[model samples]
Target: MLALRDSTQYAHMTPAHPCDSDDPERRFRPLSPVETCVDTCGLARDSAPYFSQHNKRYGVLTMANGKQATARRLKMADRAQQLQDLHFPGMPEILLWHRNRHDGFITIPRTLPIVMQAVDAQSKGQPAGHTLFCLWARSPDHPVLSIENPSTFAAEAGFIGERAVDTWRRRMKKLRELHCIETKPGASGEFHYVLLHNPNAVMEWMHSVGLVRAELYSRFIERLADVGAFGEIEAVRQLWAQQQAAEAASAAAQTAATVPAAEADATAQANAAPEASAKVQIALPELGANL
Candidate 1:
């Protein structure tokens, strides 16, 4: 029954674009759901990707099984192996540094132990569940679910010119295609949804499951539960639910312009997926203190 310092206020404290929490030039994309997509926007992954030996950009290691892969790709894989192995490092500094700055929650990335405990005590067989709404969906494991506005969701987490509604349903559609963080229903449809699958469903059919970060996220939450932090997790959930209820119409569109982090504070409240399948998983690390 450990309490989480009444973290209900954490939501209101974050800046509009937490991505800008650190580097102004580089907007840290909300955590990758499972693994970083090899091909997409941002730093275009060449069709013939060049694995760097000392890729200082992300500090990616280039040697795995004598082959080369991006550090971004390996981070996800490392997380998966760490979970099954149960080595509690006690803070996600790597994640925060990669994203650019302090998360406002902790000076250091909290080791997955406490987080894992909190998640388990709450979710009832549902993946991530209410707790999902509590933690930052922009973490390394969860990543940004969808920045796209409602219009994007309707188009199957895509753009019409771009949009969606029936938010949860759209989320499900997005989930089935890629492996990413569990997203909320509020995306206004004009933003970029950090999804694992191609935002374009038809494209997903031709492509492959995007990011499976959700699966890992679910597992991670459960781990957090094992260590007795459920109460804190619940407090976060209650606060978030209240915020969502108050802004039902506009909640999905909490983008930079619409929800400016400053005014957003006055209004209060806020906000992955990773990379691959077999080899690695991405986004925020999953919870499972007792696994």
Candidate 2:
């Protein structure tokens, strides 16, 4: 027997529950009522067994279908109720922001802090880390962002003074030089369109170029393993190798195709030479007889 207050609050369904009914209105009809009690109630239906109002509370006395999924849902419902109980009076049920709700968020790599450290270690004076963070904040959960206004971005990146924009540009250049980002010329400037690279790949590149310190690289690897992202570096490398192989195969095929055409042309030209000589001999008179 299940105690259900609201259909939306539980997901246990008896084996004979008409959950898959073609008639949407008749969905979730209880199988066989042992005792009919009631007042018709209006409630949002989800995945609950059909129930009736009993003493102003909705209740259903039925056996669950005994599915593992159903059990899991029951446990989840309990956990959700527990969390809801923690909500205090006068406070909204949801205080934290989530991606599911709306915009005003950016998703970045979990290993971003290590990547930033690696970037800063490359140049002591420049604050490329801050610039990178600013770029990420401005992005819409994508790798691309436009930096149209230099002064505005400079301020956002914590740069100040008369040369603040210049300072910001230098850090941008540094990021590009390290392969953390790629940029293109636009109406704004050289870095008007910036395409951020995966920081994990950038870290791997830095390690290859000796830009990342050994200790930091070790930590980065460990953190990646912890977060199940360690394979991304090797995955990127393998993808690059596959691309190179494909390009080489395409170029070789093109060369082979051109060589066959050239050979066929040469054969045709050779065969045509003898026929032309024979025609010339047939057209001319014998030299001695003509004299």
Q: Which numbered prediction scores highest in TM-score against the true structure? A: 2
Give the C-alpha miss distance for residue 291 in model 2, angstroms.
35
Tens-digit lDDT track of model 2 for 1-291: 243334532333321233233353333344322212232433212112232222122233232333633575568778866776776444563784546686688888878999999999887987598788788889878898888798999999998999999999999999999998999999999999999999999998887677877668756764564454645765876788899999999999999999999999999999999999998887676764677
Over 64-99, each residue of candidate 1 has an lDDT whose tens digit, in order, gives: 321222353467667866884586556655643443
The TM-score of predicted model 1 comes to 0.17
Q: What's the residue-level lDDT of 216 in candidate 1?
A: 46
Clashes of 2: 0
CA shift at 129, candidate 1, in angstroms?
23
Residue 119 accuracy (lDDT) in model 1: 33
Each candidate structure's TM-score, on Cα atoms with residue i matched to residue i, is 0.17, 0.53
Residue runs of model 1 more than 4 Å from their true location after superposition: 1-212, 248-291
